[model samples]
Target: MDSLRAAIVDGRNTAADDDQFIERLAQLQHEHGPMVCRSIFQTLAGIDLPRDTAEDYWRQVLYRRQQLSRILGRNVDLMTAMCDFLRSETRYLPHPRLVEVDSFERIVYESMYDGLTGLFNRLYFDEAFAHQISLAKRYNTDLSVLFLDVDDFKTINDTHGHIVGDVALKKIGAIIKKTKRDSDLAARYGGEEFVLLMPHTESINAFILADRIRQEVEKEEFTAHDLTYRLTVSGGLASCPLNATEPADLLHMADSATYMAKGSGKNTICLFKKDKRRYLRVKLMQPVLIKEMGFNDSQAYEGKSKNIGIGGILFENDTPLPVGAHVQVSITGRNNAPLLLIGTIVRIESFGPNSYDIGMAFSFKEMEKIATAEIAQFLKEGA
Candidate 1:
């Protein structure tokens, strides 16, 4: 019981010995999961070990690790590592087999990490997203997720070959690891796509971080054989309890924002803002016949639908419609049946003479009478 206290107490052991103990503890925790204070602590108090004493002992260990981390380098995020270990261990129901299962650390690592980039895999990311969202909701803290995708990655693969593409992905992964805070999580959401979970972070900070990563990606040069190429990334930022209240909603919003950045032109960062009137617009190409309602006795006008959302539709029309005009739009559904929707003109843009783009917000008050669900689902799926 006196060994650990004697080893760490003032003038009892050399600094080198202290370093070795801390390193060993970290390694042991990694291989066999978290260690209880009884396993690491040797006290000189000669008092009985209280059931509540482990937490205080753990705090001491973490305090020492914090100091060691500063001395060792920025490569380690002690608090983050500690949090991960604690979170993992606490989730396990106490059992001898459960402990043995946790000890199979290599299997867990392989399952949770992406084989290609060594970042958190999609499965692990889903778990993290849920965990972070729950914490954010319970504590009312700011949490943001960043969705990033390499710009024109398919072109890179086609031009340089898949080998070159692999190299680029690995390089980008390294950059993400280097750039992100230790407390933040980097995950490979899918092919050429990455997501970051930033705990206790605001949208502005997340945007700045995303921009920094975008700039870094843009400036990075990759060499494959005799050819050198540069790449860029597009990013989207969405915050919890702000842009969305659920994990799926948050992810969708971030993805929608990323799509928006791609649409605006790549190599940019976009922040997701919940639209008061619109959910998300999905690009669709369909011919529509529009008739002006109320006070208009004119002929029906033809327009091409650009995008459709639950809240509105953007379409190109040769005839300019007044912003306040009420109209009826008829379009063919996926089932080849004509679907009708009533909307109010909300926006208009002219690209050339006799060519105008119009935006209309559907009046949802009467949408129940129409089969809009099937049409919306088709558009959303296509989008």
Candidate 2:
């Protein structure tokens, strides 16, 4: 204690010596604990610690030291910083014996999270979305939005009662929390609808996450009235700078895509694809062999094309494929010659008990000219 007072009064130590002294002081404080240091400060300087908690007191001490160093144009010791803080007009010194009963933190948590889902509520989500959009724009980073809706949610409520529906929603919320990244923000937007905001993520990656949640929801079983049933969800994905930069526009795009997913039949994930060319979609019902890119030939599925266009193809298959899967579609071109088109499965909808309608968006990066020419020719001939 005397050595510390002498060192502070001398005040002739070099910068290196001061740093070493501060390090040793921190080591002593860590070893002996903050209460001992607080007692020492009170006995030596005759002033209370500036904050209620020991951690807060130490934090304020370091923060005030930085401020004093900047103002005085030189490094200052802990005692000097503490004395300056005690003399400051804006110091936050609370009564040591006063215990706070009403925790502001608990109130804030109640306001931010939903009562049932335990996820962020709509109000908090809106605020967080706006803040994240600002950060993404400032940092030139990517932001993705996922909009999801429960399929046949009203039916669940009407049939099994609202209690079952609520349980299903809670389960879905748990699935989302498990599937999404820690950095992602998820919120219950309203009844049976949820939204997720992903920072520094692309649209494709966001689609993968949304699809995983969809699969999990589909696999989850809900029980009520001595019966058990399954549920599914449809989702839509959009990204910043790729779809729209404005928050409202991006959300609208994702919602529109979600509506498209619902219209395409349900239990699907659709990416917001802006139709740049307004390609003519023609009805072309023909048998096509569908093969997932990363799978073997034995796993190939057969489906019939319902519509063909320059941008994409819609087909019905007995098997369902996940969204964001690369696929090769083989169809009979002019003169019955085999024409293979490389594409991606962007949407999947349950058509019947054993049938699914798959939407494949063409990827021209592999065979641009050939696939374009074949699709153009096929559409012209069909027309």
Return the top candidate by TM-score: 2
Q: Give the per-residue lDDT of model 2 (tens digit) for 1-383.
A: 22222222233233356567556556655653554355445433445553245446656767898988899999887666765665563344333232232553345456668889999888878867876787688888889999999998999899878998898899899899999999998999999999999999866557778888888888888776687999989988888977888889999999999998999999988888778456678999999998876433448788899998876899999988878777789999999999888876767889679889998876354346345655786688789
TM-score of 1: 0.48
Clashing residue pairs for model 1: none
lDDT of each: 0.72, 0.76
Candidate 2, residue 286: how far the Cα is off, in Å: 9.9
Instruction: Give the range where candidate 1 is weakest over 10 consecutive residues by summed lDDT.
Output: 1-10
Show how many residue pairs clash in every candidate, following the order shown.
0, 0
lDDT for 142 (candidate 2) = 82
Residue pairs that clash (backbone atoms under 3 angstroms), model 2: none
